[model samples]
Target: MLNRRQLLQNGLLCGGAAALSQFPTGMAFADEATRLYWFGSPARAERTLAVVKLFETANPGIKINSEVGGNDYWSKLTTMIAGGNAPDIYQLAPSRFADYARRNATLPLDEFLGKIIRTDKLMPNALKLGSVDGKIAGIPLAINAFALLYDTAIFEQTGLKPPVETTTWDDFAKLCVELTKAIGKPNLWAVGNCARYSYALEAFLVQRGKRLYLDNGQIGFDIEDAKAWYGYWDSLSKAGGCVSAEIQALDKNQIDSNPMSKRNAAMTIAFSNQLVGYQQLAKNKIALTSLPILEGSGQSGLFYKASLHMAVANNVKNPELAAKFLDFFINDLEAGKALGVERGVPLNLAVRDVVAPTVDEVSKRSIDYISSIADRVGDFPPQVPIGASELEERVYRPIADKLGFGLLSVAEAAQELISQANRILKL
Candidate 1:
């Protein structure tokens, strides 16, 4: 029997051979099709398989094998790379990109740009996130931005108009308070407080014209920015715009789930990809609006962040073939239409336009809305520094908990967070 590594490599080798026999071009067949290992949830696995099938059909000579695991993806990937068995294509997170790039775990695609791929057509900010140290380490699979999702029926019932394009954060806060009081239930919240969600906090900061990270990967803003952000939400909670601490602590998922779905909250900040789930949960129409700008900010202040789902490893034997397959997967119109935004909003410009006409009503609306505001969206911050992801979870989450629980004033929490984040980044 073959050893584990030999068996795995052999399977890939044979699969590549079988794949090559189906294509006519000898040059294409000369290279072996590459294997991809992904660490994603089971739901994503199912959607990804459909996309892969489409890719295989388009390029019959390319064989792509995917391994799906919900947990231990990073650890498993780390072990595989250590053993020289890393997959050609894999998943990468923004926070982990620098770590991989520093250790030479990923290939830089700068030389291959325009030769094998034209990134010019993609949303400029999305295309930029793939570059690390002036080289492209990976391609963005999707673009996700925060949007305010509201229950249309709740607004109608409360005699409150939906948030308009020109609505300010102050207007939104007043609306939240009015909506909560009209509902007259301690169980109901006007706005779902996801202060623990870093993206939501980041959106608030951005709306205030603050960058989340500096050029050198340092904490970009002073502690006062953080305080202003937390203070807004903390005040909103005090004004009954958010759920009480006891309820928030009992069920964390409620912020994005049934509470909003069942009309317990009038509005919540969520990603473009989550609209589908919200629609299903909402008995009435669910509408999405851009995040409100801060009063007098003058800047729209929203930023586009890459969903950075998949990446290819450098140690794989068939780098060129893997890159080709990725190109097809992201750029193919038919494949994208079939995949929809299951992975997130498609990053490929052509593919997005092609898929837009065929998607569901809600998805179409989302695409249109994002397209209208594309020019206003800024690029994501640089790949987060090592331990940055942990800082968000350990330090930031606890600080948010303290503020939500009324244990720490916004000023105190902001100071602690900045000090802790600076210390972690310094390390």
Candidate 2:
């Protein structure tokens, strides 16, 4: 198996050569067709291929190749980058973007922005997610915001109204209780898993006028915010309305397949991109809506986050052509429509509008719902801290699990989380 460093160097050299050869003869070597290697899931492979085919048709000189895998994508990507054989461009997540940015392995797009593509057309906040240290390190391909997915049939059966319009978190809790009491134990949970601790915590912090990380990459929120947030989940779990500790402990896919989709849970939080998956598994129509806001919270503090997908690589034979390919994938309406939302919600405003009419009904509803609430959504939290991504799984999971199980008091769990987070963040 190739090590990470070696894979990266090799990929970089290939991409660099491809970039150079795109220039006029005598300006740069023109021998090799620009190579763009993509790392993606098998589910997205067909869509990726369609998009690449469009790109190739538009720019006939460049050659593109894609490699598809599921579950092991991160491991493979790391190995490829470390081996210096990285793709000309590859997918990246917001949670992990800081690591690549800090290491200088990815190209910064600021130097070539308008020259290659019009950066001005992207939503400002969406554009900002791909940037680090005031440099645009990658181009966002799609945006995804957290939303509530509720079973409309279940709500009608129980005579319970889904929280459609904005409501307070306190009201949210009451609804969970009402739903749970009406449905009975194990058969129906008011809420799904609370095991997505980091995402949950960030949502709380943003709603409360705080953030997980400062723009400069330092820990941003205080212990009080963490305490209030943990307490929120603990209270709900204690009420037996949300998924219990036993259920939250399962891996995400397991939870999604079992309780959430089985209609054991009346509602759950999910990304906008998950509409297709939920539709396939859910027996009832899944209603999409914005996450409940805290009472009296101002709209200025809320904003939906763009999907974490961006392209960056350490090696490329043709940096310019690679950049152009990235730009076209995001900005070209026809190309984006062909790929659809396989990557997430398209980050390009023009592409989103172009494809909006053609998406599935469920997907269109999700997009429309989020767009209606876009003004209320806050900025995306700063790129997750170094080691923060791992810490999310290691530190936050136990606390959430403990609270869900009723084994740890909210106060105790809050205290423990703050101490651990501070130690990890060096705050």
For candidate 2, what is the lDDT? 0.68
**Model 1: per-residue Cα lDDT over 79-108, one tens digit each:** 778877776788887768776876789888
C-alpha lDDT of candidate 1 relative to the true structure? 0.70
Q: Of the candidates shown, which would achieve the greatest lDDT relative to the real structure?
A: 1
Highest TM-score against the true fold, candidate: 2
TM-score of 2: 0.87
| lDDT of residue 16 for candidate 2 | 20
Pick out the ten consecutive residues of candidate 1 with the lowest summed lDDT. Answer: 17-26
In model 1, the clashing pairs are 90-311
lDDT (10s digit) by residue, model 2, range 108-179: 777668888667667766777777778888887787777777888888988988985566778988889888
Minimal lDDT window, size 10, model 2? 16-25
